[model samples]
Target: MNRPHDPAPGASPAPRATDWIGTPVTADLLRGALDLERTEHGVLPHRLPARARAQCADGQLAMAEAQPSGVRLVFRTRAAAIELDTLRTKMAYQGAPPRPDGVYDLLVDGSLAGQASVTGGNVLMVDMTTGTAETRPGPVGTVRFTGLPDRVKDVEIWLPHNEITQLVALRTDAPVEAVPPGGRRVWLHHGSSISHGSDAASPTTTWPALAASLGDAELINLGLGGSALLDPFTARALRDTPADLVSVKIGINLVNTDLMRLRAFTPAVHGFLDTVREGHPTTPLLVVSPIHCPIHEDTPGPSAPDFSNLGAGKLQFRAAGDPAERAAGKLTLGVIREELSRIVKQRAADDPHLHYLDGLGLYGEADFAELPLPDQLHPDAATHRRIGARFAELAFGTGGAFAARPA
Candidate 1:
């Protein structure tokens, strides 16, 4: 995974497209491009130009938009920005900038006004920009807005970054269309950045997006990058919100972020699941463990290595699950793999409606060899597809189709 090295000085991770991919689009069929993501954190935002056709009368400004989740739009990039003059469909996700070479500047109205903001918006931000795609998808810059307004109307996008590439995803103020009563059931998925599409190639490629399309289910993706601590808020949110099919993908973030100890991991997990169960007593539930991340497989997690040495600032992280508890089978993926099964089994004995899927089944050693994360974390686009298709099969296909059967 030797990237040419970002034209920027230093940065990491420009990740996942949701498992939301459709067949690749041919170059000629494209109409115009609009960015569905971008903000202060890192990525930029785009508004469909009122006079786009006139603006690009020659042959430029290509884009497409889809509201996979109804409320959230996935903006795909093709050839946009006549000035930039270059665009590629390199898979982009919602994380850090793809490259670490140059300091990027943002543009508004064809003029350099500001940079994409990542935080303090109304909703969480997914991928907004990209840097490179290699081993695993490389590091790309992204901005996560906490909450966004209900609508926006504007046009223009510019990235004075490395200039290697200029693919994008911009957020809009448009409201997700309301679902008619008794429409397709809603499917809410919870998981790590992979579930969040850390750096696929674009927003729609996120697994949840892909699965949602395949299942024809409404989607509420709670895939938070660098989040998902099995915190009470998440559970409460699930309990308070609504869903017909719910699945929680846990593990990789726990291990990669190096959070929690075996002592607290199990109880926290139980409580999180417990809260979700409270929301929909009869909903089919699936609890997935981590996919194969060799970092934690044979090795006891809760291991911390120093990253400060590599970058400019002080850096350190404790892998999830404490050493002592991991050995006790309470914190390791091995532990989660077993415990998750036990949790559902014990619950299913009484619940009769619960199910489980080992993340290992989604993407493991074999898949890793085919596509590895450049940073030793996060999966690439190919892996996203592998996991998404596998998920639809295990969770929704066959008799287990996520579709509701006669009660």
Candidate 2:
């Protein structure tokens, strides 16, 4: 029953089986979603919207903004077999020992095709000695992939950069649509948990999806693992989504979640760069700061969790605040890279498309003495391919800081 072939001479015909569950998943076939909502058991994908998830009700920023790190679902198909039906949530830890399921990669026209996972949806749990949490729901699972290569290309799938998905239903065996918008340049970023790919390996080798595939662009990752915390609903979810390029990174989850000081982190980094410059007034934002972690680079945190190699099953992280708590105003990565390079050179004197990298110019300290951070604070998978090839040769090559502005 792998059907999905006949329809050559003049094409356009094969969508029968009662028109495959009435197709339509719309929103231009999803691609790194910036917002998709419609919940009640279908389509969730929000990198942060619904008014920045209703201005925070924090369950770890609602499980890191529904965990869709570089979310995906693209389209264009001559389906040989496909079925999505999600509703995931996953994430455990209570007594420990389960973890490792969320994957779902698929690709196709852009290569590596096939890789799936989905089993009994919702879970959550977490306890870590009274930090407290609970979810436990479970049900809609599905995943199916079957042969695929019946003709019309581009598929994608991706999802699960650490489960929390929602989606819910998407059968197929022939007709499918939206795979259009591809001139690249979307970017958007944001950070923490090493740009939410902690211990990176999949979800397209995240290092902001390998610096959005060496800066050709189109990422939208809002890297929320540990919720990048500069909230104001993540600067109004980066001032209402739509980006041509913009970054944020900022201090290691506010010095490992000690969450604030240095007078409310310099007015929460000037009210999160004034609500992302009221929707990217001039785009090209940047602002990185925070890398060479080495126990929070001058220590100060709420970090703690180092089950001293629990009989070698490993689990580490240590800076539990206090390098003499920087005379009480805390905060470290060397005082958030000298207050984000003095608030991006005092707001680049009236924001000249403001910029400021220095996250140790992408993982500093002699590449951490030749690549270290094996969980003293993220960055693995060959330091996410050496910080996505040094942030595509420092922000898209040529004169950097998100180059491309020559007319």
Candidate 3:
């Protein structure tokens, strides 16, 4: 096999045309995607299936599910070099700053092997002030990873968690085949932006991805950014997906959007759980409350972008709703935590497999003091590692819900 390699931090050169073998990006060679749509350019992975997506018209959910936070190409190959042609849709905010290109993480035999990013692609420009977006067409880009050990090994190329990527083509110097399932428990997780990998170093470094690694489980992440607002469609998506372990991180997005009052939130939570139970009656289901966000702990949200530092090329967020609104049934982080705890406790009376996790135990005020959130909302990369470690301990540790069972 040709041993072409690149040391630069960005894109890599593709293998020579005639010498490389082409492989179709099929669902069997992919993980973490609930549905795959055949686009004009290539295949697009979707976190939510077509039925659920058809029910919602919200733009945020549409974009979030299409980003493929935990999606990756998984296969067995002896290829010394690999190349992926992709059409990526990158996001840009008007008057703010150009976000860095999304990263692609490569793993060999469950270990991080290399990392790279595709350069120019479609740009989705959003006007933060007007809440409107325009898409500008661009060309497909290639990301290559070379110099493998040249032995039979399992390989995974994790797609960017924050960008919409359409897989155009995959090429390798050697032949490729479907990797047999590794027998790891499939962990399906649903959460907010933090779980969606905001500010994470790479796709595999996201908290859910990290925890999945530490827990020795295969992951299907449904962590939609800014859209986990207890929507029925989202809950249905979680219900329909097959998984051995299921976790839903609630409250953060609810508070961020101020989408519902306490009365509505309670029934919504129950209904969401009910739908999931229909599909997974005895599956181990864990409900996780939101982590500590000082800005939204007591203050109700309708969190708005703190563009005060936009001129300095930094964009932060701030809670816009008044704390006094909580008295009038408005939801806050603190209130949501308390309600989630109560609801889980009440339902656990009959549901032996149901569990509740306090997000504070994962990243509380103490941790916040040491590693503050850069955007005043999402955790930074370091915090992502910390949270992932704590979660693995709490949920998959001995006597935890995801602990291994002996035959």
Candidate 4:
């Protein structure tokens, strides 16, 4: 049997028509269609400082000079009370979020309703370094809604969570809203912590947010923090959401999270797509694998923990042992880099609308080797900006496959 990294016996190239990488097309209809969009990185986990240098180009937007320089992410929320969680990781030396001040602007059906209290877990951080994980709630905040005669239409939140969000519960009695009519198109993204930005500057700075702006697609950021395991439930979630264009970024997630065996990895991926196909049979779907991270590049770690941050009774994660175990047949970035073409090839015989993109198309091993993740994990704000811009160019720029919702 060939290793997951073996060459394809007979594989064909991706369809050029579907590839808008260098080609260019501009459709005016695509702007402003996103009901919920995090096209840029908003500070996460209520941690990092809200600071972005305004360097937005013709097709790019950043605030290199804006006061409170960080961008804010406002999302529709329709609940009496909302609960938010922050993160704890092996990376950051500081254990708390920068702001911990959770009340952000709230919009009720496009109306400003003051600020909402962030409840349940003030700075909830999960330690994944000990070979096992331990989770604790940080601070609890509650936002009370009042004096509405009838059912409320939507809940909007301005975000700059500097730490990270592990779980979110929208406490709303209203039903999920119906899809708006005649939007040109919608783009859906699925991915991991990088997608989640484990303490990147903020929610808006995360690449997914920036990419949405570049493409002008109604964005559904399903980039779960530490939860893009190619799980069937997640696949079900993607399959259920309505979208015109969809993409899944896989690989580094599987490698870093240390989930699945080689045998299970590829099949799980296929199964994930299979579930998605059940819902979106013909929509253009892109499959993206991991970008480069030297940490797991050659070592193929179920990674050993780095307990340097476990301050006095402050809960330092357990360290990884030598020879980070490589249980046979499990997958790694090195493995994925070597074998992704073959895996995608097997699926191509029947699925033409499906496509594959090497994650490095945005950032590569060379980039990581030079930039290096501060926590030996997630990228810095500069890298995030770089990746977001590249993604906009290749995925949605001129030759991109995005179209705005027809209004």
Candidate of highest TM-score: 3
TM-score of each: 0.56, 0.37, 0.96, 0.60
After TM-score superposition, the amount by which residue 99's alpha carbon in candidate 4 deviates from its true location, in angstroms, is: 7.8
Error (Å) of candidate 3 at residue 356 is 0.6
Considering lDDT, which of the candidate structures 1 and 4 is the better prediction for this target? 4
Q: State model 4's lDDT.
A: 0.52
Clashing pairs in 3: none
Predicted candidate 4 versus true structure: per-residue lDDT over 334-354, tens digit per residue:
677666667777787798777
Q: Which residue runs of candidate 4 sit more than 4 Å off their true CA positions?
A: 1-121, 125-156, 160-184, 309-327, 401-407
- By TM-score, highest first, what's the ranking? 3, 4, 1, 2
- The lowest-lDDT stretch of 10 consecutive residues in candidate 4 is 58-67
Over 107-219, each residue of candidate 3 has an lDDT whose tens digit, in order, gives 99999888888877899999887889999999998888876776999999999999999999999989999987788999999999999999998999999999999999999
**For every candidate, C-alpha RMSD to the true structure in Å:** 15.3, 17.2, 2.5, 17.8
Selected candidate, larger lDDT, 3 vs 4: 3
What TM-score should be assigned to candidate 4? Answer: 0.60
CA displacement after TM-score superposition, residue 140 of candidate 3 (Å): 0.3
Local distance difference test, per candidate? 0.50, 0.80, 0.91, 0.52
Worst 10 residues of 1 by lDDT: 59-68
Worst 10 residues of 2 by lDDT: 1-10
- Each candidate: how many clashes? 87, 1, 0, 77
